[model samples]
Target: MEDKKKFLADLRAIWRGIIGDEGGHCPCCDRWGKIYPRSLNETMARSLVWLAHHSANGDWVDVPKRAPRWLVRSNQLPTLRWWGLVERLDTEDTTKKHSGLWRATKRGLLFAQNRLQVPKKVYTYNAEVERFSDELIAIEDCVGSFDYSAVMESNT
Candidate 1:
């Protein structure tokens, strides 16, 4: 129970570090904006969180599966509810199908890169997660494991 609490606390802290606090008006517009306190709405805050989560390797499961996991693990609403924010930012439909797999549209990528405004802490955390993923791959290489390179060769 203690470990779970610590993990949740760490996750929340990491999220807060990535996405600024809710309830603050947009610094750019200085208008009172509707902030997402429960991670359900489309706001700058949720965008950063989505960007960080999606940027991690092997985390690109389809929205249906991935969104529920995020909601369950984070105890917050699914990020898909915030897709409108991305659409608004890009003014385009970011849902695309590539070889039967749904992928981000070009506009989605642009929105993530330019509009998310992920904080330094979030960037650092993503870097660490990526490094961890690389380390796992290296360890697997050392074990003489059969490479499944052909399975998703077209993906690259």
Candidate 2:
């Protein structure tokens, strides 16, 4: 019985470490720390544009199966969230088989449409700490039509 209780406690602790808090916010954002700034790459910007296009009608969209592996494999989606460009739905994953739903933010749409001017670099923060880390990156060009072919062609 004691071993089972300890195992459950360990699971809870691990959950807290990964999920941070109930709102899905990371430790850095929780403290309102400054976000780190980094150069945006063409591939990521294009991905955001793609997201903006799909979620334009204000509907949450699933990450396409054919999406660039780097988007999820490399954690670009979370990076987008750091820039206030994309957001994930906070629904519980009871089956624990799917990643979750996502959508573009209003800011993201404007940026993708070339109406909003963001820095060539964007601010990002450390997910585990309340301070900005140099590893976070942001956006760049997203001009042209809402097509996934361009993204698919990229070598990333």
Candidate 3:
């Protein structure tokens, strides 16, 4: 029983690390969105279960939020009850007089990073990627226009 309890607790913590409770616009896609930490927790649970069965030797698993219904349904595994706990841990106003959106703080991000033991791969472009892309475009321009038909003929 003790072992079972510990496992559940560890699972829950892992979940929290992935789907952070804080809400923010997805920095990557720039789609305005919100994710409750509980939702993040749910994602982690599903991902870990998948990883356990599919590839034992792999060090990382990629979990994408593919279904909207999964998030909307509160009764799903990990439960809204856990979300309530997340709210308590991260929220400032119990009454929610402020905004309902809960932004992830630096502390929250660090906690998730440390607990999950996985690097957070943000999709948003950093300055370096942007600079490199710009340079590539300039190089392409300098090469002058290439005939598309010529290239296609060479392939044949």
Q: What is the lDDT of residue 154 in candidate 1?
A: 23
Point out the higher-scoring one by lDDT: 1 or 2.
Answer: 2
lDDT tens digits by residue: candidate 2, 1-156: 999999888865764555433324434445433334455556668778777777777878777564556665655666666567889887576776546577778887777666575555553345532333445333334433454443333312
Q: List runs of model 2 lying over 4 Å from the truth.
A: 1-36, 64-75, 94-98, 123-125, 128-156
Candidate 3 structure quality by residue, lDDT tens digits, 1-156 = 999999888865654444344434443465543332112333533322232222223222222233234432432322322211112123476785433222222332222222222212212222111111111111112223433332223223
Q: Which is superior by TM-score, 1 or 2?
A: 2
The candidate that wins on lDDT is 2
Question: CA lDDT of each candidate?
Answer: 0.34, 0.60, 0.30
Worst 10 contiguous positions by lDDT, candidate 2: 147-156
Candidate 2 structure, TM-score to reference: 0.52
Query: What are the root-mean-square deviations of the candidates from the true structure over C-alphas?
Result: 16.7, 12.5, 22.5
lDDT tens digits, residue span 1-156, model 1:
999999888865655543443433434465543323321223333332353345333334343455545533553222332332222122244574321112333333433334322212111122122111111111122223433232224224
Relative to the true structure, candidate 1 reaches a TM of 0.21
Q: What is the Cα-based lDDT of residue 103 in candidate 2?
A: 77
Better of 1 and 3 by lDDT: 1
